[model samples]
Target: MVIKEITYGGLSREHLFDRLKGYPIFLNEFAEMLLFSPHFCPSPQQQSLSVAEITVGGLGLQQGGTLEEIRKQARLLGLVECPLEAAFYSRFYFTDQEEVSKKVVNQNPPGALVIYSKPLLADRNFPRGLYLRKIKGDLWLRGYRCSDDYVWSPLDAFLFQVNASSRTLE
Candidate 1:
């Protein structure tokens, strides 16, 4: 699979949101809480990253498991968690929402692209993760909170950071 390289940083949170004006984004309550929380700090310096989009099945968890299991599988497969800023950058750079929506409409599947990063605690200390999905022609930047026992689906797509030197899985 081809890896996508993107540069992130050098912009304030408000500026980043302003840049996403033309693009559609829907933030859920959890997402809003997380974004406004003190924990959602973006990097100050610019950094280039190589990222990969893969499915839970691609991580060798056909039946899926909890987040901990998912992370372990990703590490074993030579994938690393993305930084928190990656969620913002990925949503900003992923301009092909219409195409993704088309595919979801035709395929009739839940097409959400989740950015795998260190889970941040939102209100009430809920662990939140960011995901992007286009529904009814509207793009959504949603946040989800799942328990430790929650089992992810095999078809669930995840975006992860790829080490530049280690492209091939172990």
Candidate 2:
């Protein structure tokens, strides 16, 4: 597992966007909607967070599972969901192309790294999750809409909060 200490919530939405404008980022329509929504509010003070990147397979779901199932497994493994702002800051700070390439190369079936957070409702009240991907040398920060029964792929990577009690996995 790759763990990173991320500090977020000090900047406004526009400032964040301006900072990200220089990067190779592509936000889908749903992502934009979610970002600008009233539900998406950053913290008033800067907060430090520890985030871990793991795959569905790593979570012991060889066949993949629904969002609820995945969350259960994560809980069993001592992992907790991240905040919505973690996704934005994660994409903003994860600029090391080589590191991302290595992760992609290690995946049996490469896929986006979806941040495990409280799902935000998008258009039509669809639950949305933030995901990061490196495609054709360009970084993507997109929002994916999934229903309660939607099953995530085993190869899909998830970003979760690393709490103090979380067990360390090799």
Task: Give TM-scores for every candidate, taking all chains together and pairing residue i with residue i.
Answer: 0.83, 0.84
Q: Which segments of model 2 are wrong by more than 4 Å?
A: 97-109, 122-127, 165-170
Sliding window of 10 residues with minimal summed lDDT for model 1: 99-108
lDDT of 1 by residue, 1-170 (tens): 43688888877777767665556576677667666677788677888898888888888999977778989988876788888777877887665754354352222136788888887753435646788777777777777766667778887888899865674642
Candidate 2 per-residue lDDT over residues 1-170, each given as its tens digit: 78888988888888777766666587777677767878888777889888888888889999999888989998887788999987888997666533244442322225577889987653536547688777667877777666677677887789998876766542
Off by over 4 Å in 1: 97-109, 122-127, 165-170
Q: Check candidate 2 and list the clashing pairs.
A: none
Q: Residue 50 of candidate 1: its Cα lDDT?
A: 82
> Per-candidate RMSD vs. true structure?
4.0, 4.3
What TM-score does structure 2 among the candidates reach?
A: 0.84
Q: Who wins the TM-score comparison?
A: 2
Per-model lDDT: 0.74, 0.76
Extract clashing residue pairs from model 1: none
- Highest lDDT against the true fold, candidate: 2
